[model samples]
Target: MSPARVMVVDDHPVVRDGVALLLRNEPALVVVGSAESGRAALERAAALRPDLVLLDLRLPDMLAPEVVSGLRAAVPAARVVVFTAHGDHHGVQAALDAGAHGALLKDAAVTDLVAALRRVLRGERVCDPRMVRDEDASRSAVARSGLTRREYEVLRLAAQGRTNPEIAETTGLARNTVKTYLQSALHKLGARNRVEAIGKASEAGLL
Candidate 1:
């Protein structure tokens, strides 16, 4: 059989290059294309029609959920396997809701990542087994915060090292709108900035 055609989508050039390099040695997997953002990913998918897409959650032009949607629409034959730094949370749920086949945390060993890709290509649903569990649920912090669902989403992404423009691209909001939401979230959490807000959210089990 021909090798399984695969595409990678990530905003980070090093990540894209690394994944490509790793797959280059796999006898059954071929790197059909790679893109640096959601729109570019869609555009390339339209042409390459790869068998799988290793999708990143924080893209420069779109969120993981939206990227999943666009990839499915653009290439129905291609399955999406979310390759992200984020652990299981509302963001992962949203990606699943958007029709992703599987998810793998970025910290997984390269061998494990490769194995998960093969499993997902075989039509199995897989996610990070060592998922981050909610260790604490201090409702008091949340009660004191009064942050909305959107605010939680925004904060969660911010906690994952996403910049404001990246958050806007991922969340499909204007850059200014994302900044405003971030400010509001910070205020609600009594956080002086994004880092503090993220810490508060983690303590509240909102991450």
Candidate 2:
């Protein structure tokens, strides 16, 4: 098989270059590109069409989930993996909900990063072990929120930065139907807007 084409995005030159260098030495991966900002990341990703993206949560211009959503919109087929120093479950959940394929802490061993890349490429939803422990909490919160599966589906699509129309197309539902579900989800989450709903859901582990 050909090596996986990868891109690195981080505002910090040190981290970005360090990660690029690490991936460059791997025979199974190729450093296809690198970007130091969110805008650049999106532009380069669209042009380079990488198979995977190693992204930082705190970019100079955007947060993790926003960057994840932007990357997803820029390259629908490319897998985004948040490679960050932050390990908070809320942030991790937000990234995953926003269409990230996986997340890894900066402290991860090179071997672990390689393993995660391989696993995610193979279609596994990879997460650092620390983030997995919060699943039960998120499940409980989701249960308590009382969102129906359909509503949850709409919410997840919204969390990924989809508009009502986009969510309608994705779920094969009408625009009104998507709006209704989103309204109900907002009510349940006590959120005023789509952004608030996504943030609340991520914090509650509902996403």
Question: Which pairs, if any, clash in model 1?
Answer: 62-170, 63-170
What 10-residue stretch in candidate 2 is worst by lDDT? Answer: 130-139
Each model's number of backbone clashes?
Answer: 2, 0
Whole-model lDDT values for every prediction: 0.78, 0.83
> Best candidate, lDDT-wise?
2
Q: Write the per-residue lDDT of candidate 2 for residues 1-207, one digit (tens) a residue.
A: 899999999888898778877777799999888999988998889889999999887666655777798988888998989887867655677778677899899999889889899999998888888655466676677679999889988987776667888889889999999999999999999999888887788666565
Q: Judge candidate 2 against the unseen true structure and give its global Cα lDDT, from 0 to 1.
A: 0.83
- Clash pairs for candidate 2: none
Off by over 4 Å in 1: 132-207
lDDT for 72 (candidate 2): 85
Best candidate, TM-score? 2
TM-score of each: 0.66, 0.69
Error of 1 at 83 (Å): 0.8
